[model samples]
Target: MKEERVKKILSLLEKAYPDAKLVLHYNNPLELLIATILAAQCTDERVNKVTETLFKKCKTAQDYASAEQDVFEQEIRSTGFYKNKAKNIIACGKELVERFDGKVPDTMEDLVTLPGVGRKTASVLLGNIFGKQAVAVDTHVFRVSHRLELAKANDPDKVEQELCKIIPQEKWTRSCLVVGTHGRRTCIARKPLCNVCVVEKLCHSPDKIYSSRQE
Candidate 1:
């Protein structure tokens, strides 16, 4: 029953959001790494705005590694936690240059080893940049997964694990993009538009169609 529901939900979401993908603007793996870091607790729109200048200033691992800390902080200050983010970016870039020869590591294990990068960020790089089968359980994925009965775990790692088990390996990365987009457009945190949601019938939330009756 769960497996059938998962399939149905995935199918509906795929149709509803055919163009769903990573919204964070990045030119390359290194830019994606920096964008993901800047995206923490911040919206992708904001990150894109900040990265306009940030990317020009620090294009490569070597450029970021050699960038002045204060200057980098000021450039990305709008992303929040500027001090820590700047420090992490510099450290991560230096490590990327020294360890990976200025190339973003494709493996999850290697990507997570960098400073300020967690499973979420690594998953982004793997799924988006490398086209690897990875599930990135950001806030949207986390919420939508539970609401759709795709996962019941409290933590992102566990949720990602459950999703991986149910979703086909080939669809894992695309599923993240589709579901994340759905969450942003329909299954919003405060008030979901369940009445208009393409997968409303598949949603496990009790309030899925409750708002429709009020209309």
Candidate 2:
């Protein structure tokens, strides 16, 4: 991708979603960490619904560590893959209490070491909590990046690597957030609303409809 086109797309995204923020609600990094875990293979709405009550009971790493596995699994059953999620969450909580003084780690290396925390989740924490420059390639980001021709890779890791090489370092987090926002609102997975998209003219997606632009 050309630097000029990338900058233009970014500028349009910022303008379109000036107030874009993480859809997952959380009071702290720990809550966000757990929420992100529940969010895997689940919608944000479902995760939020589960967390609304779950967070009230489990306020800290120690709380989760002490939670009974069966009970915890029942609590988050709506999020899908409850067994694995519960096990991972409890293990991660215990790890946090044992290491890092019960606080979520700021660095990617440390964060990814936790159970259920992968590069995507770690990037979200780093960007939102630690104010670090990291790109989180979720489903939305992956599709949007490919649709925009900003990344040609199938895997999230490779796509993130490709983006980091082109997108300015400081704008990594913002780019992810805004592009994700666009993906959710306009450039959706099933049927994109290309005609209403602000970057329609700039987009080169073969899936694009009602736009004169072509790659």
Candidate 3:
């Protein structure tokens, strides 16, 4: 996409969803790390619901590193993949305590070294928590980027690299939040409401369904 067109799309996206923000609730890096892990195949709403109690119970890395495995699994059972998530959270906590002095590392290199933390997860922490120029490509980002032609690669890491090339570094995180919200709200996977989409005219996806809206 051309720079001017990308600019227009981003401008309209901000206008369309001025309040779009991260749905997973967290006050610190540890909370977000846990919530992101729990959000693997689950909805942000469900992750938030589960983390409401989980955060209070596990406030620090030491708390998680020492949590009983079976009990921790039950705490996050509703998030699905609780067994793996629980195991990772515990091991992640241990790594954090042992290596980073119980603080979440700010760099991608250090963050990815922790258990269960991948590039996507590291990007979230980097962009949101550490105030870094990073774009985390989750399912919504991957789907919407394809629809908008911001990226064409099947691999998400490649897509992220492509997006980084076009989208200004300053707007990387905001653009992802806005576009991801667009995917969740209007550019839905099964039934996209193209008629009500803010970028309908700009989209060239074959799946776009057009109709006159009552509003």
Candidate 4:
């Protein structure tokens, strides 16, 4: 509810997950963009496993644009939603080539114009790829922000606004990384491990599991 309290919670999170950061493997902005799209409803680990071979095949926007739909689908089939994702990836590549000259746009406006790219993806790109201030509100960030009482909004965009109001601009990326890590490792969706959570005292989630037996 207060800025000081939110800062303290963020600090605790940093201490809890000292090495927390984006786990999705990528060598460049384009690779990260494709990886982010493929990561929809899929785990980073799984996405990484698929991209291990995908990046080798599709090196550029033209590669993806010209990639045989059937072959690309088969390559990324394990990430789920193969048909739709494949279509989007192809379209995204085409859009980049036609509009941005085969480069990932750094701005939010341009990034969202690409196929399969939403505000969340745009934010991730802005922060990590473009070195701008952004809070990528993925499912984990959304859920964890609510549980921590740092945001009350039902919409991800509104949640980002609420968090930005309390968290410093420089810490936007840090907040997403640490809080998201906490959501995945400690404050989980089904049963949060509040007993061992570093920010448990600051959290007010009704779903918190205070006892080991409860989890």
Residues 1-215 of candidate 2: C-alpha lDDT, one tens digit per residue: 49999999999999999988899999899999999999999999899999999999999999998999999999999999999999999999999999988999899999999999999999999998889999999999999999999999999999999999989999999999999999999999989999899998887788986785543
Q: Which ten residues in a row have the lowest lDDT in candidate 2?
A: 206-215
Give the alpha-carbon lDDT of every model: 0.91, 0.93, 0.91, 0.91
TM-score, per-candidate, Cα-based: 0.95, 0.96, 0.96, 0.95
lDDT of 1 at 112: 91
For model 1 the TM-score comes to 0.95
On TM-score, the leading prediction is 2
Model 4 stretches astray by more than 4 angstroms: 211-215
lDDT score for residue 61 of model 4:
97
Candidate 3, which ten residues in sequence have the lowest lDDT sum?
A: 206-215
- For model 1, the stretches where C-alpha displacement exceeds 4 angstroms are 206-215
Instruction: For candidate 2, list the clashing residue pairs, or say none.
Output: none
The true-versus-predicted C-alpha distance at residue 77 of model 1, in Å, is 0.8
lDDT of 1 by residue, 1-215 (tens): 87888888999999999999889999899999999999998999999999998888788899989989998899999999999999999999999999999999999999999999999999999999897889999999999999988899999999999999999999999999999999999999888888889887666587474544433
On residues 58-92, what C-alpha lDDT tens digit does candidate 3 reach at each position?
A: 99999999999999999999999999999999999
Misplaced by over 4 Å in model 3 are 211-215
> What order do you get sorting by lDDT, best first?
2, 4, 1, 3
Task: Estimate the TM-score for candidate 4.
Answer: 0.95
